[model samples]
Target: MCVRYLGFVLLVWFTGVLRAQSAALHCGAPSLSGGYLVPEQETYSHESELTYACDNGRKPAVEGWWATSTCQNGKWSHEPQCIDEKACIPPTIPNAKYTEKLNGWYEEGHKIRITCDEGYEQKDQDATAECINGIWTSVPVCERSTQACGEPPKIPHAVIIHQEYQEVFAVDSELQYECEDGYTVEEADGKKSIFCIAGSWTKGPTCRIRPGTGLGGSTVGGTHGGHTTSTGSGTQPASGGGGIRPGTGLGGSTVGGTHGGHTTSTGSGTQPASGGGGTGPLTRHVSNCGKPPIVPNGEVLETNRLFLKYRCGTFYKLMGPETVVCYSDGTWSEVPTCRVAYCAVDTDEYPDLKHAGVKYIKDGESLRFECVDLWLVTNYSEGRCTDGRMTFTRCCNKFQLNTNIC
Candidate 1:
């Protein structure tokens, strides 16, 4: 230990001595005072410096310790430093039921499951609790089952076997009722025709019966015959046979009594009963003999426009007034009124002279013409008129003959 100390002290002294010697050597430039003094006369000041470092959690170790000095100064006095220590730690969540099952720390990416207690059903799937930042997500609740049917139905003439029945009933269980013998049975729409299906009973049906006499044609009582009977008065008994008198002279009378009247017969007549005169043969007379011949009102002047009219006894066409039909008595039907058919005259200057006087040329009418001794006349031969327009073929007169006439 003493040798080490001696070495450190020697090193310090050597360094100081070198600096002092360097300070004493004023070689090239003159001093600001303009005095040519030896380097041994120069003076030097010590400098202070600092370095930075950090401890556990502190700030800078040193503050405000730095200086500049001449090269002849001793080693730096002291170095400054800083101390800093910082770290991050995780957060904690409280009262989380299933969070503990997630290893140890609940960090950003942790997950956990949540479920309802027994006898309770979850509306959705089991939820997952996520550790977002530091808090656990909310847990969902469970719900219970619901009832099916709405209300019990009403039944007529028959009473329900039990009151306040369950909302759901089992299948194939029948509902029975009793009605009077003469009445019929009926039911309501939905509930009345209800059949047992699946686990629950459909709505109950209503009961009814028709009101009338009983079956077997009896009127409320079981009697087959009645005691009251009808009788006739002053006339032959309706139950037995009898005869009719000869001179009764009833229209419907026969040797026996008339159908609706009583009869009386005696043994005193001497002359044989004169037979009634035989009914004469039925006869009919003829009058107003021989039908008269029908005379037409007038004769048709225009053959194309003639219309016929018939007499009273004559038969004619049942439809239009234009047609005439003969009667069964061999006579022509009366003639209807007649009118002239007038047509418009065509005045177009046709090139063909032969078709000049033709009036109202119908469809499909055609004509050809030739010039007489023409001096080479053109557009004169083939021509036609359709819909009041003239179409003519090209023609020219080739020669001249007689100057007076052809």
Candidate 2:
């Protein structure tokens, strides 16, 4: 102890200034991530330990979690941490689809709810997947319901220009398309169609765009607010009854937020659509996009701008479109895909440890670990395959379950 500290303490004691001194070894209540601590303390004199537990919908990510932290001299020996509750991956089955898209990937303590597609029925089973400990417990399969064509596949940068009232594309039925502005149909093969041949539709042509129409030359309206301007300078059109020339339009999303609509120049009184649209109260129009994109083994995880968040199935990770915009023009900003994955565990590392299920687990797959009889486990017994990795608790078993090695 420093002489100054002792002198100050003596002065305070004699003057009664130490009367307001607080309890010894006072500390803030134990703080933990994804969980809370039991028996939070305000003051401590002797060494104490804290018990930790994950909150509802959360689980421990790593194995061998200590579950407790020690407090000594007002300082914690180690911090307690736990994983957030996870959800199961989207259920996958051939000739089937989710009844409704989900907002996020499956997680621990959550369930997958869905139904079979039209003309298809469950082969005497339920369409559900349970999320257990950050892994899917089971996946449902859907058999063929009908032989006719299911929903036509979605084409990027394009939409269904024509369809019947029933929307059923029966055998020999045909679907046509007209690409959105700034995008054009495949002119090479000239196959912009969906022909319901037999039970499946032929490969549909994709839409293509160059990204910009007019760049350098002054545009009637700049790309600031997704508006089109009429290129004019108080001049008349060419001798051929030329009115004001149309200005270049912007593509993708505009700064001012108008989309899935057309941009025309209102120059020279020849046209009257570019004089800055009305500022009157806007009326809500029906969404052009038919619900959000439901990618194969994925769902609309979140709604951002027009861009959406697409979460892949359990074990699988997303390849593209972390953000997408739902267009008012009945088109997807950019759809995403979910790629299959393999587990990230190294089986060779655990000698004498036996595992069942996939020797090398795949994403969304699970494996069980166990020790020989008379032996005990120090780490988690199960591992869930997710995104090329496994989230498991630590294991260290050098002794028997009920008896210590002495």
Candidate 3:
């Protein structure tokens, strides 16, 4: 160490001598922190160069951990500095500016708030970003005012009718909703539109079962919100649309009776309707959609004023819509077809086989078997089921003698 120090002193002395010869042309030693320079000297000649290295976990303020600086006309070409390697540089965001003071190098866990320029909007809830472990969190995006709202929120029992879903929506954009089978908007006459305003969507309607109807139109003796009254009893119309009439028969002809004046007591037709005993004209709801269309081999699982859900019978599968809707034009939606399905294997014909008992095997399914007795020839058999038919590949005899057959 002493030898190296003495050689460094000699080099400094020689540099001083050269500086004295051309005092105006020589450059003074450059200043550096958190690092050390090579060829330690008090002064350097014009056009002289030196390299610098930073301490551990630090790097030169320029490009890399080590850098070179040139002395020209008594000044260094680049200033040398050793900065923390974990320091974060400010991010550049288009159309956005930091609200707080920005530093050249920020230590870990630093935070900054940003604001969008005029005519632009922030895309995140909080317009702030934090630096952790030398890395900055995702910065909020600043988009034009036109792209203010994100994708529309989902509602219950309904789907937005969009050709393709989008991540963002422009202000004042409109979206429509289609209720699921057996459901309709609560407000039957109201529009089914949802609009994007500012950065949110307008309140949308709820999808509820249509009034005055049940699944498959099976519910009976129900009233239509007091709009109508039962027959044989003296009662005033709730809406004052009509008055009560006198009963001609002993029980005041069943409410909603046919024109012939014969009342059938089946009890299934006791639906909400306006009927009176007198000989006056009976008025029905002009917009009331009648019973749904019948589906062959398909029973109604759910029914409403304008919707019906049908389910296929056992061993039958539905090929089309399970639920049909009644449009405003008094037309019922297309009814689905019930096609026969071969989902089980028939074992009645194979009495001599080991699997004589009945067992259900779906189409395109199979079972494998081997000889039960080792004394008999080792034979394998497979029963493959397809379209209600099972193919028997081989059979083994239960007894090794003539009494047994395979």
- Number of clashes in every candidate structure? 33, 31, 7
Please write out the lDDT profile of model 1 over residues 1-406, one tens digit for every residue.
9999999999999999988766654222212221122232233333322223333343322232222223224432322222221211122322223435322244455666544332233344334656563445554444321212223345555555544464443233454444445544443122324333222334343344454554433211001212211222211211112222346543111121122221212222112133444342211111111122222222222222112333221111122243343321223343343221212222234333432222332223443444322454432344455544445444433232112111
Query: Each candidate's TM vs. the true structure?
Result: 0.15, 0.25, 0.25
lDDT of 2 by residue, 298-365 (tens): 56676643356678754356797686664323345666776756564444466534432123456777
Best by lDDT: 3
Predicted structure with the largest TM-score when compared to the true one: 3
| TM-score result, candidate 1 | 0.15
Estimate, for each residue in 233-307, the C-alpha lDDT of model 3 and write its tens digit.
Answer: 442233222222354333222334244232222223322334445464332332233454545445678865446
lDDT of 2 at 243: 22
Evaluate model 1: give its lDDT. 0.33
Q: In model 2, where do residues sit more than 4 Å from their true spots?
A: 1-286, 289-294, 301-309, 326-330, 341-351, 359-368, 373-406
> Which portions of model 1 show Cα errors greater than 4 Å?
1-147, 162-164, 167-184, 187-204, 210-406
Report lDDT per candidate. 0.33, 0.51, 0.60
For model 2, give the 10-residue run with minimal summed lDDT.
234-243
> Quick one: how many clashes does candidate 3 have?
7
Q: What is the lDDT of residue 246 in candidate 3?
A: 51
